[model samples]
Target: LRINDPGIDLGVAAALYSSRLEQPLDSDAVYIGEVGLGGEVRPVSFVESRLKEAEKMGFKQAYLPSPNLPDSAQKKKIALLLSPV
Candidate 1:
């Protein structure tokens, strides 16, 4: 399979890697974003849709790029974890 998107899973991969493989990320959380080589997370496309899909799939939380965070946060049932710009 081919992953045309630069590296959308890098954020979560970095977190898992940084933990020295001793700890794991929250299984109930959804992480969305592209991580740069410098460990900074860049915004990805279709963030709102992604969050909505995740919420529908039983994910209660999401970590995404700050710029991609939706303004309707107060109305969403899931928790959106906005990254700092």
Candidate 2:
């Protein structure tokens, strides 16, 4: 099976967001990564810019691939879950 590289992240986010309506997802959290058809989370490029934008938007948490993570203090607040988010 093939995954639509560009749309995977948005598709995953939409699914996650819809599922969280009843449980309530963390409003300050952001998710940035590609969800493969095998359910694996893959890293994307331009991570710095993405994280910078998220931070600017007041997001206190982020779920991203390990390889895309930064060691900055701002990134310390991130939450990475390899499994379904």
- List the global CA lDDT of all models: 0.69, 0.64
Instruction: List the candidate 2 regions with Cα displacement exceeding 4 Å.
Output: 1-21, 71-85
For model 2, how does the per-residue alpha-carbon lDDT over 9-40 read when each residue is reduced to its tens digit? 84466557679885666777677787677877
Per-candidate clashes come to 0, 0
lDDT of 1 at 23: 76
Could you give the C-alpha RMSD of every candidate to the true structure, in order shown? 3.0, 5.7
Please give the distance, in angstroms, between residue 36's alpha carbon in candidate 1 and its true position after superposition: 1.3
Q: Give the lowest summed-lDDT range of ten residues in model 1.
A: 75-84
Model 1 per-residue lDDT tens digits across residues 1-85? 6677753675557577759877777777777888878878888887777877887888766777787767764436445454443
User: Which candidate number maximizes TM-score?
Assistant: 1
Cα deviation in Å at residue 22, candidate 2? 2.4
